[model samples]
Target: MSSVLAKVDWKSQGFRYFPLKLHYQRLFATRVQKISLDGGFTCPNVDGTVAIGGCTFCDNRAFSPSRRVRRDAIQAQIERGITGLRRRYKLEKFIAYFQPATNTYGPLDKLKTLWDTALEDPRIVGLVVGTRPDCVPDEVLDLLDEYAQKTYVSLELGIQTIHDASLHWMNRGHDHAVSMEAMQRVTDRGFEVSLHVMLGLPGETSEMMLQTADQVAKWNPAGVKLHNLYAVERTPLADQVRAGEVRLMELAEYIQILADFIERLPEQIVIERISGDAPPKNLVAPEWCLHKGSIIRSLTDELVRRDSYQGKNCRMQGLPREPS
Candidate 1:
């Protein structure tokens, strides 16, 4: 198996798996981890500006750390996160990740203040601001563009799926067109863009999920996070799961779907994550998701078995030719 792993130049493969760490190292010349922060942010959808209840499948608390409450001051949380991460990894640097809720859905000055505080940390070399596509306005983009020139600034948008129907079913507040416009503007400005795409929403079939990847390939994101739909407690999705209205994909089924999704993606895109894992205590279904590391290893093994890598099926799907 080690020989099989060696047979492929995983680094050179057009569609590589889990390439973010190496990509960061090439730029920063050091190891970096994301220090997740809760910015005490809220979504317009949940606030009645758009619609209520947020996304059907979303329960932000599912993945948020228990110690980092939303009420904590931004710098206080960062201090704690730095201490925790440094102790665990002996880390030298980190990117402050604004991951909780819709991180940009706030007053412009407040937004600037939160980000400025996080950026003020000496150990934080960059900012990874995660937000909904619809939430990022021209003002937010302007701020992010300025930061991009000074340090490693990345805008992580949750594009979930390219299908409007799926967007609607998920109650994502904005349509696919909104995501397209936001992506175009962000990438055009030369800021590194990373997008979030979910594979197995309730109504999607394997073919439909792969189609989403094809659409993402056209955008040519700098990084992509592939997530599986897992039922979490206290979300409408959980109710649907309980009512037998929706079915989550089995673990093996998700792995195959993920490989197909990755193959359709262009090689230049750094895969930030292959599978999504909710905290075991918060996860309501698909117990297999708890074993994230094992799932990633299984994915690499499957790729080896098939003698395939990220973009082996790209041209076959009518995607742009990989750069020589």
Candidate 2:
């Protein structure tokens, strides 16, 4: 562990790492939930501009509830999401998250209209757009800047792994260099960037996964969402799992590796998510992922066992501390 952990009251907070909820409280002074919205966008990979099939492990419908339900007007979706989220959580302020597909892979006019419609609701305090690294051109970035100037805007880039061979195995279309270029470009624009990384790819070792984390720490993204590479029904990865060609990480193994991964990240990076799961009907393997609560609890326990917190082993020096 590093000296940084000495100043954090992680034990009292019930999480050894910096969680997104805490980050939100610091920024908004209240709990802010994310309302998932489908902007009716398709990926370059799915549309044949980049490649034929989407990422082998992806079935957007399985990952996003917005995609599973009927598509509605952007404003209507905001209303519906707000109503549902309000029913469950006490949060009033929400961030409009364009989550299902490549949100930036659209005409600028259409993108602006959708984003504008989402912000029309006063309760919506921020915007999150998820997309591939290759999809955001300079014009799209400029458009995002237009929004960032008005309100909080986070661009979630799907840099699943830093290993090019793993990307090739997943048919990710673009290589690691493309991700680095995208990161540099987004950072240049001064937009808050959150990276999405998958830990349990088909051939990656634990060391390889930690290497990805170490590299990401150097980039120093505003946030990171980590999840295991689980298989979903109707995807190529599912077929491989059924054929015994691929194996998924067990819960205990994933927790340990995730703890190690977080230790290598800068403490300032918000841990947006520690695990991900598909809807039970769409999930094909790794039944353990369905229990998100258990995954989080076990991971927290593992971190407690080590008496460590985020950045405990971080090599990056002189990074800004989390805002006071």
Give candidate 2 regions above 4 Å deviation: 1-14, 60-72, 320-324
Best prediction by TM-score:
2
The digit string of per-residue lDDT tens for model 2 on 1-324 reads: 011233334436777888888777766779999999988777778767788777998874433312322235787888999899989988889999999888888788888888888888899989999999999899999989878777888899999999999999999999999999988788745457899999999889999999999999998888999999899888989999999999899998999899999999988788999878588998898999999899889988888899988889999845764332
Clash count per candidate: 2, 0
lDDT (Cα atoms) of all candidates against the true structure: 0.78, 0.84
Q: How high is each candidate's TM-score?
A: 0.89, 0.91
Number of the top candidate by lDDT? 2
Enumerate residue pairs that collide in model 1: 14-267, 15-310
- lDDT of candidate 1 over 118-193, digit per residue (tens): 8888988888888899888888899888877777777889999988999999988899889988877776663677
Candidate 2 vs. true structure, TM-score: 0.91
- Summing lDDT over every window of 10 consecutive residues in candidate 1, give the lowest-scoring window: 1-10
